[model samples]
Target: MSADSTHAVEKDDAVFHLPGHPLPALVTLDSTDGSGVDLFMLSLRRPVLLNLFSMPVRDGRVDLPSVAQHECAQQLRSVNAELDALKQQMPELAVLGLSLHAPECLRRVREDLQLRFELLSDQQRAWTDKLELPLQSQDDGSQALRRCTMLLVEGQVSRLDFPLRQPSEVGRRAIELLRRETGTM
Candidate 1:
């Protein structure tokens, strides 16, 4: 991370620092549309709400049968709905979903949930590893990223919500942050 990417704020003798690590410039993933997405480049163009999802893996792929019953999937559905509303209000924001699932599986989920944002696949775990995201051990003894949300501005993680407790609150929190940053709130 570059010095310029580091962010901090001071108010009334209190200091708040953002996440220290900026996403690597070379990070890329396969979008559900079958095109390569340069995540760092996208962050440069607009603020990105990057939502990370972890799903059960089976037979070298995300277990499709288990998704419907998975809590993460339920959380994803709520988050996606909230993000859709956020996009309607702020079209400039770039909302993306990232997971270890294959592109085809992500596409199916997108369609099923009527998600408005793009879904990207990190099948090789390269991007997650680079970010050093926390991993959750699955019942099948596989590892998947823990559910989290990141706000990336100009390739730097400005805000992060790890171990997200309320899936429905994510968009509201993001809106509050963006509005405060833009002086619209």
Candidate 2:
């Protein structure tokens, strides 16, 4: 393989485990609008807040029962509300949601929740597989992407919250980071 290809493979093999790690530049995700978003580029332009969530998959399709769907929606709403508050304080922040659902599914969720930020599809699991992100067991006993939040500043992870038990904590973590960075805490 070419040197560049080897370097790319090496980068992809490096699992991100903590804050201050650089996000791989080649990471791209499909937004609910069906547009490709290069997260590294977005972070370069402004701070990027990324929330990773997952829905149970059955027979290779998103499978969320009524109660499960309701719970997911509630979690998303809580996260969105926190992000809205954060956005009010920092307009330059680019809030995004990532999930294994298809773009169409994400679009529906976004519309249903009236989310203020974009939700990106990771159906192919490129971001998760490439980054080697942590996985969690679903209600069906299948593995799914673990819910986590990450704050990227200039393409480098500035803060990360893994195994997020409370979705609303996503925004609170970002706010805390901002406060510490600005010495306003």
Candidate 3:
């Protein structure tokens, strides 16, 4: 239930092994679709990828639901915007937003960050929970998810990123990897 464990102290040590692990069967979130879509189902069609981004700041620090403020939520929005460009660059991979919180809470994060990608709620996060991505919780209990990306080549583990140093450059990197894998680049 808690994503605290996902974020580990040694980011490089983050875990990502899904080849043997069947993808979770939870419902996908579709904020962009504006009608709530199932991301997991979509990924099943092809290769559904994921990247969890931690927020620099949070208002849930002190029951902010009663009193919270918009803070440094632009980071994810920026990344999501880049996803579009990245989409063009990859042209084949479907992007997914694997947030620490379920869609309900992630909804705010998405809105605050102004993200465009399809964000799915890994509630149990059966797949990401043990991955040790990155996390930090406020005294109030609201925690931040770490930053990482998981690539699925035909619904298989193509690559998994743990606390990636430069998610912004992920597009270029994905392009290069795709090129190598598909012999296009």
Candidate 4:
């Protein structure tokens, strides 16, 4: 569906609501370049693979450790690299990663992983609160958004995977969904 006047632009202050039922002009933070990315605007140009992770991955798991202290930012980087390669096959596909971390930390992780795609930061939980994604209680008495991924075809939510069972399979899973949706493979 083309982004036109039919789709209402939902907004509350700086928070934009992207309901699972499907909404238009989705908005979220894109701290990857120290600027915000309008997901809807971007998707209007092409399909989007939005991966929402709880926190930065370190040593194969999501850990709250300094980038220098962590030996590796596994899981995500591996999946991202795979997905980046698949971009050649799915020309119109845009892969994006969103995490609930500060931009500073995200930058370090991005540099450490040498990611080709953007890794956005949602430090204020603006998107999370609006999405109302499932949350898990942390040992520190705080709640964290569960890791999940969503496929947005032309700015509309198409498919979602909650509490991603296997982080390693993110690329493959997204590829299969995109191929199935776009009939690319």
Clash count for each candidate, listed in order shown = 0, 0, 5, 0
RMSD values, in order shown: 5.3, 7.4, 6.9, 7.7
Order candidates by TM-score, high to low: 1, 2, 4, 3
- lDDT tens digits by residue: candidate 1, 1-185: 33322222212111123365678778779997778988888888988888888776777677778877776677677667577566765678888888887888899888776777788998898888877766778777777766666777887777665556665566565565556445575
Question: Candidate 3: where is the Cα deviation over 4 Å?
Answer: 1-11, 16-21, 25-41, 56-75, 130-144, 167-177
lDDT of 2 by residue, 96-172 (tens): 88887789878877876788888998778877776677777766676676666677788776666555566545557
Q: How do the predictions measure up, each by TM-score?
A: 0.80, 0.79, 0.61, 0.73
Pairs in clash, predicted candidate 2 = none
**Local distance difference test, each candidate:** 0.70, 0.69, 0.51, 0.61
Best by lDDT: 1
User: Candidate 1 vs candidate 2: which has greater lDDT?
Assistant: 1
Candidate 1: what lDDT? 0.70
Give residue 167's error in model 3 in angstroms.
5.2
Which stretches of model 4 miss by more than 4 angstroms? 1-20, 23-28, 56-72
Off by over 4 Å in 2: 1-16, 58-60, 64-70, 139-142
TM-score of 4: 0.73
Output candidate 3 Cα RMSD.
Answer: 6.9
Question: Where does candidate 4 clash, by residue pair?
Answer: none
Candidate 4 lDDT over 23-122, as tens digits, reads 3345658667777777767777887777776553444445655543432244466557677565866777788787777777778677777777778776
Best candidate, TM-score? 1
